[model samples]
Target: MSRWPNLKQLHYLVALAECENFNRAAKACFVSQSTLSTGIQNLEELLGVQLIERDNKSFIMTPIGLEVVQRARQLLSETKDLLEMTASRGGSLSGPLRLGCIPTIAPFLLSPLVTLCGETYPDLDLLLREDTSDNLLKLLEAGELDLLLLALPYDLGSFHSRVVGQDPFRLVLHEKLIDSYEANPARYAGLPDHSLFLLEREHCLTDHALSACQLADQAKINPFAATSLYTLVQMVSHQQGATFLPEMALRAGILERTELVAVAPQGQMPHRDIGLVWRPSSCRVEAFAGLGRLVTSCLR
Candidate 1:
């Protein structure tokens, strides 16, 4: 049987691959640069292959090195999982769990969910990342995150998802603009092209809001696009334009001081389904399901 490098050396390799600089990698690994270099060199000797191509100016991973680093990451993750499993067997559920959430849902949903998680699973080490849907999915695919909480009709063919609940949208109009919307409903049907303020293009919430409200042929929207639900509320409070928000957010005190009127859509309520997503190959499926249950319980 061939010998193998130690886990310490594998850690150094993964750090180097991520940082691409010996000094930075060493810092990340909490070791001196020389120590990191020596460890990598020893690893190379044991593996009988050069993993990195480096000079004073730059560091590049050899093809073999890239493969090694990828496998090293997986190995480390599995090692962590094994340890977590041992802890679980010992009647504990303590380990770091990286979770990603989208902007629209994060503000309103996370507070209650986090509280519930702390109360129910105090041993879980939760690390939260708030980002856009696109960015969160990328992180989930790359193994940087253990799971994701986001809204659907999102296309996630590569990931496994479970619908947790639905959050319906509410039309938020400036109090002063309410009369205009009430008196002239027909004129405002296409108001997205005229007076509506929407989340920036590419935000899934934007599409959810627009489609749910059936504003596809609306008038020209405001030139300024809000980056977040809070920003949209702020703009609607201060400006004459109207926006859409999820009911949970509005009920969560997002409209405390704002002169905004919440209106139901004319037909069936417009809403988006929220879901918990994880990679199909993830080992933490049970823990993620527990988290989903907690979220569903708290949100309801």
Candidate 2:
């Protein structure tokens, strides 16, 4: 018979990897430091590999330790899903569901989504996290997040996703700028060069906007990038430059206090698809789909 590391040992490894301190990891796992340390030793002994590099002074996770932590996370997530699957087999989706959303969409959708989820699934505990798309996706992949609600056309990378709604991009600019463009439409010609302000490139919203609006020329983009939609709005409010804002934000009254104008582009309306994404191994696909339908309703 072959020996294998137990779930408890793996959990300790993950906690240790994250905490980087034995005392902290032990506290996180609700065990004594010696107990957690022994469990890690046992795991390494069973596997016949040094998972952590140790010294008299300090310690660091070996390269293999980091890789093991990643796998341990996945295994733990799978085990959790398996238990949840069994528990939810004969009942409604009822558990703590950790959901992640990108920053741009979170402000506009989180309130309504929470309200709707509370009304629809009273038994379900919906946890929310808002971060950049890249960060959220990383969390989701690590099993720290159960699902994601974000703008689509993102590379989900083996995750299953369903586009639930379309969030069209509207050209937003100062009232004076739009008035000038309207007065001389030919001179403006869609978007003038050196006039489009965008969120920093780290945000997927920036890429989505650029792709949707076909703004490929670097000359069209202002060198001064914004860190958030609020910053972008503030920049445009000061007559800095034009920008593309999602319609949901406009509907949520992002421009209520300001005198900015949000209008459709000249030809077809450019848009980003709003989607729900989850790991393929998730057992709550139908529940997520139902949630997706609710999201679509909120879009209306």
TM-score of each: 0.87, 0.93
| lDDT (10s digit) by residue, model 2, range 52-127 | 9888756899888889999999999888777777777723557788889988999998899889889998888999
| Local lDDT at 41 for model 1 | 94
lDDT of 1 by residue, 1-300 (tens): 378678899999998888878899999989999999999999999999999988888878999999998888877766765665566653344567788999888888888888888889888888999998889887776567878999998988789999988898888887777766767756456344557888998789988888887776545478789888888888877876788888888878888877788887544778989999987766666777788888888668
Worst 10 residues of 2 by lDDT: 183-192
Computed on alpha carbons, the lDDT of every model, listed in order, comes to 0.81, 0.85
Pairs that collide, model 2: none
Per the 3 Å backbone cut-off, how many clashing residue pairs does candidate 1 have? 9
Give the number of colliding residue pairs in candidate 2. 0
Best by TM-score: 2
- In candidate 2, which residue ranges exceed 4 Å CA deviation? 184-192
Error of 2 at 63 (Å): 3.8
